[model samples]
Target: MNQFIWSFLCGLGEAKYLNRTFVMDLNMCLSGAHTEDGKDVNGKDFRFYFDFEHLKESVPLVEEGDFLKDWHRWDKKKGPGRMTVRKVPTYKVTPMQLKRDKSNIIWRQFDGKEPENYWYRVCEGRAAKVIQRPWYAIWKSKRLMNIVTEIAGRMDWDYDGLHVIRGWKAQNKKMYPNLDADTSPDAIVSKVTKLIKEWRNLYIATNEPFYYYFDKLRSHYHVHLLDDYKELWSNTSEWYNETTAITGGKPVPFDAYMKVIVDTEVFYRSKAKVETFNNLTRDCKDGINTCNL
Candidate 1:
């Protein structure tokens, strides 16, 4: 998902630099790492996780399917030989050099090895200084935002968010020796009590798998987890129905990546936000002893 965002930003930057309408592929493959079943899932619609309408407002864009259809129509009318096309096989062919090329389409092919084939590479080096990534142009799907709004609204928009980065980090003692102990339920209840008032709505944004792991904090605060609002993306929900329609009647699972997006957005809407690295433990985010870096 991180790679997808960066690559999209790079593409958007390229389009802006060339003063051209950006052709975007709405279909995306969700990585295995972010899937619930630990397998890569294909045919995910971009609208499932982002606001395509909002993106269109921010940039001159056309869906890839529409773009291809137009290209084929032109090919039939003028013949394929009449249309000018530039095939870019390497990032070494900088965008700066192709700034004045008279090509109907500048096709970039990432057929090289790992890192080298990365889409963001086109924006590195001198190109980085010229092309700026339009981060504001991309917004999370309003559908997902609806869920975030519903969760916040349920708490009357008055809540304190706690982001506890546990999971592998806590188990990896060599890198985060104190993470497991510091994020323990007992430790969380002890430390959080002093920072937030008792009996307040507390939303815990965590990767902890166990639903009952944060039960210890319930005594003092109304603890809420992402799982508590599963119905928002369930079969009966608007999100599920809309996403299904976009995907031709296929249901979109609320995968782990979607959970993270919702979790982060809800955390942002909170009145007070607490993080694990600095607030709950002394371990560095990257690892131990790297805090000063």
Candidate 2:
């Protein structure tokens, strides 16, 4: 099950949530929180863990403990592979808002013209971010090392993700670059069009890890969510059955994104809740696992 920690305060320099505490089974979760052990106000029964250290950063430490004086030794990829609040970029996002916005947005597209303000009301007064999970991109390339070169050659923009799989400061620019001179720009563009035609299923909710994911799944891409979701939802006066610019009168979604799935693999960490396979169907949102989305 998913675990979550709430905000509570101890004697000094400590913040804990007495409301609820939880235990986490982090196969790849970044953070988790839940209601405290008991229902009523408790001293320190609530629990929390830093999965960013273990999954993303490879740090390993005790998962359950009191938060007053002890800290876990979870890994941090950016720093000493250690777990710390100062590690992964974090924002104070309300889980209710995230859940409501994500869920209700789909209904607007599913039905027709829900109030535009409805979407904002869910996301407003909430903390959110557009984090670039670069590790996911790198992990993707390593997963598809075999097909990366071929995928590069077919870029409509001729941009190869293989080059910067390690980052912009790759060891050998001569060996790998996102764009290639030999491939005609026209040909690159054509290839992109052709590829998108066949791979539209894989991109709807995806962003940073497109290259490797597209290569493996050969799915079409979708636009990135952060680019304009907030603005579009904020300014809109009416909701529509679909959120795409092609159908909704917005600017064209980005080519690199526009078709990828976003957070296609997140889950609510519930054992009792039955997971639905159809939620993230490619036909629905290009295979975005929306139960987790």
Candidate 3:
């Protein structure tokens, strides 16, 4: 059964905000590489997330209606959006779980069992709006994109790239024991040697700050990191300073986020890719190496 599903908007949190890029990338891969869905997932998702149908005060981009305000005022905020007959009763699925999955039904059927045929009631309305549109799209910062593009283009898209995601996970030895052990600078350097030949261009994307960690790769391959383009992304850059001001000192680490986004995009467009383990598949992760594009 082919059921058309529409995703519901949940509040943006730390992990979800980052994870959505992967989802959008997956959708892009499903469609093809070097192409985008051309939709802004962040804007559309959050617009619904922040919709205040109950309040008299206007929320940006949401429709204004007297009845919506009156109904909510009388009912004392029964729900966030209009209710539909489609009540998919799920148990033990917390808001956090929903946030992680982004309302995709496929993630629930990972045990080799056939997934049930169900559709979101919301899809009926939104389906028309998204006609001829791709499944997912990402919202990327333009300034960051421009800078990263210029830097990535220097390699002429002819390089093998590595995505080394070592930061909190690597530091926390107890919680993610296997991940921590395998992602150490020593382990990464040892493993990546077999993946790349000497004299190849190697682009690395990592949260680790130790410039010396990549010395081995640098010796073998023409190494590139964010530090290579310090003039554009470094804290001293005027663009970075101005962005911080416009963000009003946002509590979140915006600069770190820019690196992650830029790195993900650049690596996605690379000639070949590699990443940390995918225990479930016993491989180097699906989206990283096998983009199927």
Candidate 4:
């Protein structure tokens, strides 16, 4: 079940033309980025939306033809008005959902009954490849995740200014639906503990430079897979800054994440990576305060 299931290309809209490559690996850092091809913004209506896959030709229009107009802007010939230029999301347009504007794209988002299982699919695969495992496979494992559930109740992280934790239902959707979190405490203690230990060993042997963690915009907790991006463009301090802003600079935000309620974590970078791990069951241990290595 730990195998690459599905993936999408990483490049789009950045170029005169988008260059995309499918994620063959499951363990790699990935984020869902939306394009303004024709998608609606909050309180703002739009003509349509299209997935970048459908983007081929560029259309023409007035001063602000598209939201890109602002970033790729031109001065209006004559107009006394301040307008908002939010790009439309044409990338997600379905054949049936085109032309007509959607009711809303921004909603109180959650993993719901299903966590798109896309959760970390791209990340794991990339990580597998990084470790020189050419035939790596990654998928939502209701089985292993069940292991997490029974033992910890949930695994959470701080993402894009949001506090995120997986509950039974949300984690279920993210896991293999047919399976359930290992309900028995003993099972979690035995099986789940073992896997983590083994994975840790394998990871240590690789001696990777840095492990990057990006909260999926939509799905998956991608561990940056490419050799080029072992660490994030920003450092641990930058991440702390972002988390602080998300929580309005609350003093105990990091503590909250590491404590029982929040359960947030980041992978270790080279020097930051350590063989020592503090068991949550333990009163305390070293490196618990460290962010992504």
Instruction: Indicate which candidate wins on TM-score.
Output: 1
Per-model lDDT: 0.90, 0.24, 0.48, 0.24
| Candidate 3 residue runs with Cα over 4 Å from true position | 1-137, 234-254, 279-293
Assess candidate 2 and give its TM-score to the true structure: 0.20
Ranked by TM-score, the better of candidates 2 and 3 is: 3
lDDT of 3 at 245: 63
What clash count does candidate 2 reach?
A: 56
Between candidates 2 and 4, name the one with more favorable TM-score. 4
Winner of 1 and 3 under TM-score: 1
lDDT of 3 by residue, 141-194 (tens): 465667767877898878888887665555544544456567665666777777
RMSD (Cα, Å) of candidate 1? 1.7
> On residues 155-272, what C-alpha lDDT tens digit does candidate 2 reach at each position?
3322211111122212223443322221222433344444334323221232233233223333333322222233322334121212232234553222221112112221111111
lDDT of 4 at 252: 19
| Weakest ten-residue segment in model 2 by summed lDDT | 7-16
Q: Once model 2 is optimally superposed onto the true structure by TM-score, how far is the C-alpha of residue 271 displaced, in angstroms? A: 27
lDDT of 2 at 45: 12
Top-lDDT structure, candidate number:
1
TM-score for candidate 3, residues paired by index: 0.48
TM-score of 4: 0.23
The RMSD of every model to the true structure, in order and in angstroms, is 1.7, 23.1, 13.5, 18.6
Rank by TM-score, highest first.
1, 3, 4, 2
Q: What is the lDDT of residue 13 in candidate 2?
A: 8
